[model samples]
Target chain A: MNKILTIMWKDVRVLFQDWAAVALIIAGPLVLALGLGLVTGAFSNSDAPTIGRIPVVLVDEDGGQLAAALVDVLTSDDLSDLLAVETLSDADAARARVAAGDASAAVLIPTGFSDSFTPDMATGEMPASVTVTVVGDPGAPVGAAVVRSIVEEFAARADTAVAGVRVGLTQLAGSGAVSPVELPAVGQSMAAAVFADSAAASAASVIRVETRNVTATGESFNILAYFAPAMALLFLMYAVTLGARTLLSERREGTLARMLAAPVSSAQVLGGKVGGIFLGGFIQLAALILLTTLLWQLNWGNPLSVLLLVVAAALAATGWGLLIASLAANAGQITSLGMALTLLFGILSGSFVPLNDAWPVLDWLSRITPNRWAMDGFVALAAGEGGAAVLVPVAALLVMAAVLFAAAALFFRRRQGALLTA
Target chain B: MTTPILIAKDLRKTFGDLEAVKGISFSVLRGEIFSLLGPNGAGKTTTINMLSCLLPPTAGTAEIAGHAIPGDTLGVRRAIGVVPQEIALYDALSARQNLEFWGRLYDMRGQALTQRIDEVLEQVGLADRAKDKVKTFSGGMKRRINIAAGLLHKPQLLFMDEPTVGIDPQSRRRILDMVKELRDGGMTVLYTTHYMEEAEELSDRVGIIDQGRLIALGTQAELTRVVGEQETLRLYLAEEAGAAAAQATVAAGDGAALPADGGLTLFNGLPGVLRASAIDHQIVVNVADAGEALPAVVGRANALGLHVRSVDIEEPNLEAVFLQLTGRGLRD
Candidate 1:
């Protein structure tokens, strides 16, 4: 135990002396967290109506009074301020525009739209409704819904005005002295008058939607939260690599053979090396977490759980490093193997990208990686739930660490005999 | 004297089918610097490693400091220290730190560890540079630290395998002197080196190894006597002495003429003939038996108008003895 502590102390001293290692372990995470936070912030605040523009397309097919009235309504300064409408000559062109994402939606008006809304037409049969076709990226459901709201309001106003016009016409006919020519002229005037009244009523009925996002928990996802954990894991890998490099250096310098010549047992030497690597990895993890918290306001809830996860993750990482170093004959072999393992495990662990709903095979493979379990624990803790749930994964990580460390120790002991002979 | 500090009775080690040490046996008495002198690939290191408990001999038993090796490896390790051929100090750590760390490994702690570290540092003449990192140290300084680390525990037996290879002349001499000093201070040392001079200078008794076998073992005088009573005589002749002049000079010496070849010829005993050089007018003669014939040979050469240059007569040393026994140079 004393020997292990001595080895750990030496490793810590070396880590503190290296400036580049300090920066990568601490500052790198904070920078990443800040950047991710700002991006999430920009995405959430995009729904405000402050001179912001939403692209829309106008498809007017009627070329008549009512179609013109609808276009005029859409082009008014008040609506234009919220939306940027591009006029398309035909429905086909507007659909193409929306499909290609050139605009958010297409408003189509049928031919003879004004005639369809007559008093006789309203009472005898229901007029064909003008369709507002919104073709949009399904991922942007909010934008599509906003466009639909505007069209729905416009339709309601048009319906009420048509009903009023039909009632007035019926009253005029009850007077019993109207001529047929005067009736056509009155119908035309009535149609024009109804369109104007409906436009006014629609304008008055326009309800501006104000969106307020509320969550039960007030936690905001920031860059620090997103990148702090990842950077911690990355630096943990680097610490392992550094420790492996030390092993190679000792072998090259023949110090390993000299150590074998001492009274210390092979097991003791192996234990010392593993302890050193674990200590370095722990330092890196702590620095990353602390820097992320202080610099970018990263929230790592349940400190005890986080601490446990970090320890498990460090052990697993250091074990992997020692195993690689033991198998490798030289520094180059150690480096190549270390890099391959780190990248393979890091990707599977979802350090760089989310793998929540990944393929079933990938999910199973991730369970075998300590990094995956560690990242899951961190994300769960930071998201403020699943405290007891994280214990299984953390234990799995520790088991993996123990298995790797044992394998490394066995390899080192076997090699010690060969090294001594050499 | 009681148990013989280390004993290897027919110790053998094999790599695959090739035997590195072939049933070699030797013993080191307490407080003696015993050397294993050999060329490259002569199993000297293999023997040392087995005795040091770093390797288990393939077919024989050895005891280190009264403890059986391999069976009681820990006991052997505790009683012995090893200074390998290669430098073994950590580069990142200071000399003091390295010593302290190694000392702690041997269970030396507190002020005792510090005191031992200081003593070893002073003995190796590295006390002043103890605070400096080993990477900044010279080859000799690193070698000294390597030796110091081995001595931190003050073991009864020390195994030094080619400890002075590729070092400066001064450092090599210092190390040789230190080995002698250590032996004098009551530590049994098994020193191995390819350099015949180092073995001849420092070893109380030398074991000459070749082809994984001990070819010869004895004191310097005892080994030199192996070449028999014949002495080697060298004559430093003037450059102007032609082959004929050299040949005539050898014939004139009071030794039996054997053959006349190259620039000169050898005589079985002494020749009574002389010839003079053209430029310096000098004559040189070399004889196999110089002691009985030197005075007569010198007189005859001077009477025959031959100016004698210089003469040296000495018995065959280890180098000659080795060459005669192996039909090859000691270094080769």
Candidate 2:
């Protein structure tokens, strides 16, 4: 262990001693993340052009007032550019339209849906909720997901508006602002208007512009949050791979041969090299995580969970690094192979962009990369899902570490007869 | 006299069909410098590598500091230090760091490692440059640090393989001096070099090797005795007039091929001339006296109508012994 630490310390010292390398490894990822976050974050601005319209089929089974108002809200002039709504009479036709790819989603409003959400409901009494069934298309999930979000937002706002109308109209009548005979009509009309227009537009107009942390959402600043950690993980592989490449470089420089000539065992030498790569990768990631937190205001996840994932992620990355080193004959080969693998795995695992879930092949390919598991872990942790929520990702990361380390060690030993030296 | 610090009997190494080190056997006496003298690719470095534990021999029985090879590799390594043919110090690290790292590998730490580093730095005359990065230093300075690294643990035996292969005169002198200093301080040294002068100047005993085999081994004086008391007479003729007409010029051992001046043939009949051979424009005459041999050598050259550029007398030495044993110069 002492020898391992000594080797680790020597490599670490060499890493930090070159200030250019230090700046590039630590600051390069931060600068890149910020640039990407800003570029991607720009599109999420509220004032920017909204996405294209989603084709939606609406089937109102209930000829009631509440169901009619909800259809009016979805087809209102304000959402005319965002949602291409088709009012269909047959529920089977609406379902077929979604299934046949004619529409992104079909919204079915069952009978008695409007009855439970009427303005005549007693004040201070809980209102009976309704379930809006939205059948979405498998081919066009993005459009379907957008339509589903707008509908859910409308339901939440409409529920709030309906409950407030009853108590407010009575108060207004008592205060003499409105005549008692016309108060009920005024409350119904206001509730109807609330359900007629764009609830999302109104919500957006309420909040002032401000930057916030990265979360897996479509908020104004969520892109920055999404990209910052993803970019950090992507570039972290380069830093750690460079650290691993040093094992080959040391051999080229003859330091490894010199070390072997000493009283130290080959196992100790390789252990030190492996330790250096693991720690270097860990330090690079931890620094990036901290930097994003302090400067970009991006929260990675639960601190302990991030720490645990970072350790496992570094180990797994180092395993790849050693594997690259083991296969490489020299530092130059390692550098080329390491950088190539870094970019290949980074892009493959959806570090730059999400893998298309519709494509099972790409998803399967992504599972083979450390980036996928690491990103999944970070995503879960960032969602504030600490504790047991992180179990699978953490376990996956450990498994990756174990399997890759074993493979790398086996190849490295075959090449150099060392514990982990490449 | 002194108990042998290192002994090998029938050490051999084969790489595929090629035998890198053929059945070779030699030993190093305590506190003595044993120089393995050979040209490049002569298996000198291979032999050093085998003994250094860098490579395992195909077949051998050897022990260093009472530890056997193969069976006690770590023990053998613990008892010996190696300054390889290449400067093996970390270039980016400071001299002190390089020393410290190597020292730690030897399991030396605390004040002992530090003191040893200081001592080695002082010994190699690089004390002032200890804090400087090795890459920033000159080649000579880097070589010193490399040597310093090997000496940090102060093993019982040191293997210096062609340590001064490429260096300026001053640096080479310092390293050779350092080797002698190490020997004088009671350390066994096995130095290998293609440079005959370095071997003759520094080694107590010389092992002449060629083509993966040690051809000859003895002290400089003992090896030189192979040529007896006869001195070598060199005739430097024009290249066109040399090895081409060397036979005509030497005129055989009895001077029968040379033109006769009156009744006596022009060369070999001289009292000092013992034997003669022709090699590349140089007619080599082994004689009892160089002064008496010079006139006869010039007379023979004139009789053969070959132009004699100059004459030189080479005393019996390791170079001559190597040439005498292998029929080739040591540099070949």
Candidate 3:
């Protein structure tokens, strides 16, 4: 372990000592983020362009009170500037409209979605839960994203309302204030009151834009929030590439053989190299996040979750670095491959712009990139979601890291003799 | 009679169909500078690599510092330090930092590692520049630090593979002197070089390797004794004169076939001149005695209508021994 740290430390020291590399990895992302922010008019005094009303198709299969309340919220005059709702009977046709770009999203309230919140009169128990599916158009990502966010907010409020109804019924039955036969009616009345309160709160805070302009979406949605992580992750790929290049550079320079010639095992040397790449990428991302936060006053969300995303993202990016190193024959080849992979991943992962999910093939390819998964987590956190929101993205990034690492290790094993020898 | 610190029997290595080390065998006694003298592509680096545990031998067994090669790799690595032909130090790191990293890998730490790093730096005469980045150092200085990194742990055996490969004469001199000092301090050294003069000056025992084979091995006197009482006569020819003559003879279609050795075959039948070969603008002849073979050898060259610019007579040395054994110069 000590030997591995020594090797890792040495590599990191060497990496930082090269000023040109340091500048590219650290300052490059920060400057690009700043430039992107400027170009997007995030810093301009003019009102940020408002998105036109999103065209949505509603398929209400439940026909229950909670489902009606959801429809009312979407079609309300207060949110008229945000959503344009069209009612459809067939769920399949609604989704087809979204897929065909005729609608930004299709909100499908499955049967029993509202009943799942209602307690049975005899058992005082609710039915099994059902979900509301939002099929989003790949062509209009922002509009779809907005519709999705609104639906998510409605579901969260309904959950709170159901919890309130459950607690009120328990209190009423225990106190003997109402007969068991009246429990169902009382539960319904309490649910309506709670839902109305939650619906009002959701309207004022959940999906409303506070100001007329200056920034798109809500007041919390800073353009830097999107571009900052985007640019940082783009260059995080470059940082790991730099670290990976050392694997081949050291061999060509004889330092690798010298290390192998020491009393350390081949595993230890490679472990150190892997650790160095991970640490370099982690530091690059952490540094960029902190710099952007400090300089631009951009909020990146809960610190702990951001740290988790950074670690997982770095691990995934390092796996890519190792993969490139394993495939390349020399340091020069690694450099070229690394740069190409960096830019390619950036473009494919929607680092420059939010990717249009309209293309299924492109969406699937984006899933393979660390940038896409990490950007999902960062954007969620920046939008005021809790740490729980990042669990899926973090897990996906980890699995990507594991698979890529295994592949790189297999390649390294096959070329073991060539790597460690003269 | 010192005990053997390293012993190898039939160590062989093959990459695809090209056999890099072809069943070579030797040993180095403790407290001696054993030199492997061979030109490039003679498998000197391959042999060292196998012994250093960087490469596993394909067929054969070897023991170093009481550890076997194929099995006990860590033990062998712990007991040996390798200085590769290239300057392997990290250019971005300071000399002190680079040494610290290598030292830690050998399990040295804290004050002990610090003191040892200082000692090695001072020994290599780079203590004053220890804090400066290696990129700021001269090529020779970097070479010295490269050697210092290997010496931090002071292993039982140190393998210096052409340590003075590309440096100024003065730097090479300092390194040679330092190597001799290490031997005097009771460290076993396995040095490899292509320069005959370096082997003659440094090795307590020399192993002459060519084309992946150890053709000769012994003390300088013992190896030279292979060509008993022989001397070398170097006849300098004027501006490819001999080659021109050979080409002219071939062009004439004289039906007198020219030998492939560039007219050196003309002196083969001369009395007292046992063998002859050509290297560039000179012809080297091996004979029993320079005093007896000089006049006859020069006369033969002149008789062949080749202009002899000058002549030199050298006593028996590694060069003449290599010529007698392989029919070629060391630099060939």
lDDT of 3 by residue, B205-313 (tens): 9999988999999999999999999888988888664564465345545435455523345566667888776767777889887888788888867766678899989
Q: Retained native contacts per candidate, as fractions?
A: 0.59, 0.57, 0.96
Instruction: In angstroms, give how far residue A392 of model 3 lies from its true place.
Output: 0.7
Real contacts retained, model 1: 0.59
Q: What's the candidate order when arranged by decreasing DockQ?
A: 3, 1, 2
What tens digits encode model 1's per-residue C-alpha lDDT throughout B200-298?
888888888888899888887888777665454434455444543455655567234422222223322345212111213323333345666677666
RMSD of each: 16.1, 12.3, 5.9
Supply the TM-score of chain A against the true chain A for every candidate structure: 0.57, 0.61, 0.72
Predicted complex 3: DockQ:
0.76
Worst 10 residues of 1 chain A by lDDT: A207-216
Tens-place lDDT per residue, model 3, A34-121, is 7877775567765543345689999999887677778877887656767889999999999899878899899999998877887776
lDDT of 1 at B324: 46
Badly placed stretches (over 4 Å) of model 1 are A7-219, A245-249, A353-365, A406-416, A419-421, B1-3, B229-315
Per-model B-chain TM-score: 0.77, 0.82, 0.90
Arrange candidates, best TM-score first. Answer: 3, 2, 1
Question: All candidates' lDDT scores?
Answer: 0.69, 0.74, 0.85
**Quick one: best DockQ, which candidate?**
3
**lDDT tens digits, residues A1-422, model 2?**
78778889888878877778888888877777667545543345545323356799999998666676667667765566567899999988998898797987888998868656655423433346667778877555445545665666567765666657677776887899987667656766765565444434433432111112211234322344555667777777887778888887777666777677776778888889889988888888888888778865666767888788888788878878888887887778888888898888877776665543334577688776777788777765554445565677778878887888888777866866442221
DockQ of each: 0.34, 0.30, 0.76
